[model samples]
Target chain A: MRIVLMGTGNTATVLGRLMKKCGHELLQVYGRTSSSASALASELETNFVSTPGDITDGADIYIIAVSDNAIANLAGELKLGNHLLVHTAGAVSKRVLQKASRNYGVLYPLQSLRKEMDDIPPIPFLVDGNTSEDLTLLYDFAKSISNQVAKADDELRLHYHLAAVLSNNFSNHLYTLAEEYCKAKQADFRLLLPLIQQLCLRMNRYSPSTLQTGPALRGDSATIELHLKLLEHMPGIKNLYTSITKSIQDHYRRTDN
Target chain B: MRIVLMGTGNTATVLGRLMKKCGHELLQVYGRTSSSASALASELETNFVSTPGDITDGADIYIIAVSDNAIANLAGELKLGNHLLVHTAGAVSKRVLQKASRNYGVLYPLQSLRKEMDDIPPIPFLVDGNTSEDLTLLYDFAKSISNQVAKADDELRLHYHLAAVLSNNFSNHLYTLAEEYCKAKQADFRLLLPLIQQLCLRMNRYSPSTLQTGPALRGDSATIELHLKLLEHMPGIKNLYTSITKSIQDHYRRTDN
Candidate 1:
């Protein structure tokens, strides 16, 4: 299948490489800038196009892998004829690509991607389409490159995007905050790595709420007070600590009863 | 070294098993009730004692692995006669055991422990002692059962304990919330597991701040607003989403400059 890859960011580059590696024919690489388009095209052994009018026609599929804000604008600019067109975004609706072609859909990768990463992690693709035929096409294409692929409409994808933010983004922020706190107190942050890894391992087998541990879960007010006192100087972290602790306690109290 | 394990909780049982595996002599298991003490003692192939007066004396170390609230009261009942006494608590100070014996210290395991877990994860022991000799004894004892061992005083251990809560407990809470959200929406929560695992793997190499990616970090207000609307019915989750998104935006905004 001949594919036209759009955008040159992390998601774009990684997905483009994956599709190419899976034996998809890359007809052209498109980017807002000529340099980026040329770089990606060179890497994929394909032609480069920067202008909307210069985008090659009759590709089997055109994947618009730009940022959420840019997807609509880029889709409006593209002319994909009747070829299937898909945008790779979790939050954006597949309808965003409807104007670009008769067959439009989504190919959202539900994992973080970095072009510079040495190894590509497992990417679970959540797909949707304007039609059943196009959806099947996407399902097949996604399955070719990934073992994990599922159908999710815009609403479900948005829900997943929110969950991803909570589990991945917010959790990583907690880690960042913890590392900073460790550094401030002159404690070795690396020592916490094993604990973090163990938590991840436990999550695979048990519900996280069942595995919850710490002063917050134990409702140890003395320890909580000590932690609050320790964080007195750092208002932001302190507020976060207080808010999350309360949330945890409230959750269990409501659930346990 | 002959060891008298106190308490019959998760920490006590797991640590007792670890010590026994490392070839330490388990003299007895002490609990608040005879049945609980006998249960743990049977598991450890040791004797059981419920009354404080019945606790065997002259052990190399008397490990008080009870809850933080009970640590002080329990320590007061113990008669160690200069035998080393230690508590496996992260936030509690080594000084808490000083009243129990002439030689007192702490043997807090930084990792979360559960007696029911089939496979024990790496337990990093944080040792603190009142004297250099007691510290050496603890260092050797800890090194016997675990590869990762370090000396951290009360203040430092407390700091790490707080950080552990943030990274492990708080993060696990986020995961729980996310899983709940996924279940409510009928989206497969398991799909997000790869992303969570990838985040953990990335943490080993990069600082989490550098790895953060989301609508919040990207400052995409449109997507954030959509998520906020989606979470409107769930007040707790909505509040958390708003607070954490604001935090991510604020954190990077402040640091990026």
Candidate 2:
């Protein structure tokens, strides 16, 4: 299968490498930045293009891995006739490429990517298409790159994207807050690593709600108050601490009753 | 070290196993329930005692690994004349063991433990004692079981405990919410696992704030509003989505300015 990667960000670079490794013909790499595009193209031993209009035709699949806002504009510029045009974004609709090509879809890799990653992270690729045949093709292409692949339409993908934000992005912010809080009190943030690892490992076996442990879940007012008092200086954390604790307490209370 | 485990909970079971593996004599296992105490004791090939008075006195370390609420009460009943009495609690003060023995300390393993864990997780034991001699002894005992051991006083330990709650417990609730939201929308929860694991693995290399990504951090009100609308039915998640997004936005807003 011939593939054209349209972006040089972490997702684009890593996915491009995985495609090449999986024996796909990566025909071209495109990026707004000429240097980035050339660098990725060189790494993948593929052609490079900076302008969207210069994107070569006749590839089996053309993946627009650009930012959400740029996906529509890039789709407009691409002149693919009947080639499968897919945007590798969770939030952006596959319809963004409707005008560019009759065969359009999405191939959203549902894991954060790092350019330095030596091997493909166990990325579960979510594929969708405007038509059943296109969806099958996209799913097959995704399966070639990763063992974990799923078929999700645009609306369902949006819900998943939202869930990803809550689970990955918002959760990471909590970690930031925890690290800072530990630093403020001169406690080693390293001490929290094992707890984080264990919590994640537990998710493989149990629903996270059952595994929830803390002052908030336990409704231990004394410890909760102590934590709140300790966090009085940091207003952002204070609000987060108070609100999340209330949410947990309410959850347990409502469920317990 | 001849150790007497003063509970049969997850912490007690795992820690007792680790102690035995590290060549310590698990002299006796004590718990409020005779069955539980006997069960754990048999596993570790040690004696079991249900009565507090029956708690053997000659053990070198009496580790009161009970619940936080029962720690002080259990410590009261322990009759370890001059042996070091340590409570395996992060938030509880070492002073909780003051009545139990003249030489009292803390051996708070800063990791979530489970009774069925086949291999000991990398337990970063946080040690503190009433005196330098006791602290040294407890630290050595902790070192035998885990390579990652630190000397943190009760005050510092409390802060770490709070941070642990935020990082481990609170973050896990977010995963729970994410899984539920995905399930509500008829999406597979497994799709979010890779993302969660990547976010955690990234923590080893980067501070979570710097790694933060999402609608909130980007201040994409459109996406944020869409997510909030999707979560309107679940008030608990709705509030969490709104509040955590606001917190992330505020954090970035302040830092950026």
Worst 10 residues of 1 chain A by lDDT: A74-83
DockQ of 1: 0.79
DockQ of each candidate, alpha-carbon based? 0.79, 0.84
Q: What TM-score does each model's chain B reach against the true chain B?
A: 0.97, 0.96
Instruction: Identify the candidate with maximal lDDT.
Output: 1
| Regions more than 4 Å wrong, model 1 | A45-47
- C-alpha TM-score for every candidate: 0.95, 0.98
* lDDT values, one for every candidate: 0.90, 0.87
Worst 10 residues of 1 chain B by lDDT: B246-255
As for candidate 2, its clashing pairs are none
lDDT tens readout by residue for model 1, A92-128: 8888777789999999999999998888799999999
Tens-place lDDT per residue, model 1, B1-257, is 89999999999999999989889999999999999999999999999999999987768889999988899999988777799999998888888778779999999898988988897789998999999999999999999999999999998899989999999999999999999999999999899999999999888898887898888888888888988999988988888888888788778878889
